[model samples]
Target: MQIGHDAIIIGGGFYGAAIAVYLVRQRGLKRVVLIEREPALMTRASYNNQARVHNGYHYPRSFTTAYRSRINLPKFVQEWPTAVKQDFTKLYAIARRNSKVTAKQFERFCRDIGADIRVADPALRGLFEPRLIEKIYVVKEYVFDATKLARLAEQELRQAGVQLIYDTSVTAVSKGVDIPLQVALHNKQGVQELLTSQFVFNCTYSGLNQLSGDFSGVCSGLKQEITEMALMQMPESLCGLGVTVMDGPFFSLMPFPSCGLHTLSHVRYTPHMHWSDQRGIDPYEKLRGYHKETRVDRMVRDAARYMPELLKAEYKESLFEVKTILNKNESDDGRPILFEKHMDLPGCYSVLGGKIDNIYDVLEKLDEVI
Candidate 1:
């Protein structure tokens, strides 16, 4: 069977849901349908992330990404006031050894980006190990409750008159000789076709390669990796604050406001292993899923070096998700959101964002394209 729509979004994550709302409400586009393989939105990488609404401090190495984040941080807060947590203070500490940026450089970077940065309070400063950490600053960063964000997105999509289809996957995409594009969707029933009207957005995240071979064959810009995050309980003193040790193999322990638990994620230790599709083989082919006990042990062990309090935290669980990252000049640190319009195929667009707050950048770019 073939279904027709004015616009079809291939992913129903927060970015895709936001785009669907924008296209229908802001652009006055009717007959839009958003399809997702999962039963609900934000269950994948969107929900299984660090949840920090980044404000340039995390990516001092990439100025474009940092500045874009700084620009969008407030816009996101203003738009989703109910979904974000700003009452808690966020502390960013620079690593003494294997540091990416020095104390002066980090301060200058934040100042240049107009980010609110200052020395941590003397009482709060003692929480980190002085030997491993060089400097700590209180930055303007907050965590977004993915559950609240998803609920808000669902309401927005509904009010915007978007037809959201869950438990559906876009297995194949092909350009029609006469029609704009033909998408093959699979589910429990069988395969169905969706004929779009000259505009289609591929927001499938890690499922990009599964949708089209051309993305990996001709366009060749995206790189996929399996990443993990560990969740644990936090002590009372650390409940109202979030801490991150910068550079090299460090960790970020932040309170998950939604569940009242803390998440400890190590930059280099959390991901049990990472394999790339660009390595002449597919990584997901060999990998099954996340190993909870091993990854959690590594997370607590590595995080203990900076915050010994993590040693007392009880292990909750670990989440594994396929992270779709942009291959920017062979560097894995770029966070600039990617929105490719008809790179290899007309009437088709691919969207991949690094940070959640960068959703504004994605919407702005989509408005320009649509």
Candidate 2:
């Protein structure tokens, strides 16, 4: 079967869905179809992440990223007020050794970004080991409920009349002789095709390299990491609080709004491993021989050094997924959203973003392209 639309958005995550909504409601483009390989939306990196709406504090290494996040954080919260948790008091601590940012540097970065930051109470600082943590600050950052956000997106998409096609994957993309681009899609019904009038947006995130394979040298700078987000049941006092250690090989234990639990992720101890090639990824094949939790004990051991309370938390299951990150230098830990327009074929663009709040940035960039 063959279908036609004004635009075809690959990957029905927040980025793809938001683009569809914008095209229809704001841009006046009709017949936007969002395609997702999963039977549901936000099943990959979108749902599996820490869900923190970055407020410039996470990227003390990248001032541009921190500043941009500070600008978009409020926009996102205002857009989906019900989907975000405003109750949590986020705690950010600078590591005493091997930290990426010094206490003063981090504070300076936060001040420059115009994000409010204050010292953690002296009594509250007693919860952490003095040798492991040098300084702590209470920052204004909140976690979004992934499931709620997805639901809100669906409602808005429906209201905008955006066609969402789940359980469908784009198998191939080719510049059509008649149409601008022809995208091959696969599902239970079998292979099909979609011809777009405007352009094809590749918002597949980690699947960008795989989806744009036929376009040579398009996603060459892309890399993938097999990362794990450990879910733990913590005390009530820590339920809504978020904690992240600064610099180096540290761990961030933050509230997971969707599951109502805390997610523990390490900077050095996490990332089971990273794989990068100009070619596409086969995550299942790559992880076939690997046990997801084999190294989780080590992660917990390392994280315990900073937050001893984590040792007392009950181990719930872990969510493991392949995260797509830009291949950048060590000094540059910033995650700037990537937007590649027409790598080799016209009327086709590939997009990848790290954080959900960055979706606003993605939409603004798309506006200029359109």
Candidate 3:
């Protein structure tokens, strides 16, 4: 049996869920549905990672991404005020050695992007080793509670009247005779179902290009990495502070509000392995087959070199997910959202965004099309 809908959104991550809510609430689309392989929303990439709501400081190298974050930060915080965590002091330290951007350069970049940045207080500065750290700046940034954000998404999606379908996977999407697209779905028990929709949105992050049929060649120049973020109980001195060592092979430790622990990630150690999606490899399958080991020790050892207080952090566990980014971004480390409209497949669109606040970019592009 085939069920028809106005819009069918695949992959129920944060982007997919947000898009579904936008279509139904903002656009007033009634017959909308969101399908997720997992039993709930935001269980994958959305929950994993650093859970930071970027405020432009993180992207000193990429002006566009930094400015974009600056633009979207307030909007995200305003829209999801309940999920935003602003209780901690956020600091960005410039490494004196082997750093790409200098302390002055980072300060100038922050000011250029209109981000609020100030020199860290003497007390906060004492947390880091002065010999290895050149400067520490207090920045206005916030980390989000993924669990709260997930609950908010579910609430908004439900209130917007979106038909939520969980525990089902989309096998393929093909051109339909009656409708614009036909979606083939399968459950864990081998149960299959067909759904037809006027428009289909491919919001799958890592699996953006994995679907067969009309989705082929829709997205290109993509790369996926099996990334890890170690959660740890911060030391007494670092509990209320989030520190990010800048520019090169550095590390960041910030509050992960959801679990009441801090997430520790390093520039050199966070990404275990990466592969190009252009080779037609499924990232999810690669992640499933690969064995993962905890690199929290390496991360802590290296991070503690810059901030000696990190030696006292108690390691809890690690969150691993497939991190996707544009291949061109490897050069400048810029994260611009990818929005593609398939000319071959009418009423079909694909979206890939690296940052959570970049959702506005996706929503803006979506407004242009639909």
Query: Per-residue CA lDDT of candidate 2, range 87-119, in tens?
Result: 978999999898868999988888788899999
Q: Per-candidate TM vs. native?
A: 0.93, 0.95, 0.98
Clashing pairs in 2: 100-247, 100-248
* For model 2, the run of ten residues with the poorest summed lDDT: 211-220
The window of 10 residues in a row where model 1 has the poorest summed lDDT is: 278-287
lDDT of each: 0.78, 0.81, 0.90
Which has the better TM-score: candidate 2, or candidate 3? 3
lDDT string, candidate 3, 105-170, tens digits: 997887788888889889998888999999999999999999999999999999999999999888
Per-residue lDDT for 200 in model 3? Answer: 91
| Ten-residue stretch with the least lDDT total in model 3 | 211-220
Instruction: Candidate 1: give the clashing pairs.
Output: none
* Candidate 1 global CA lDDT score: 0.78
* Segments of candidate 2 deviating more than 4 angstroms: 1-3, 212-214, 217-220, 284-290
Better of 1 and 3 by lDDT: 3
lDDT per residue for candidate 1 within 71-171, as digits (tens), equals 89889999999999889989999989998789899999888988889899887888878898898998888898999999999999999999989988877
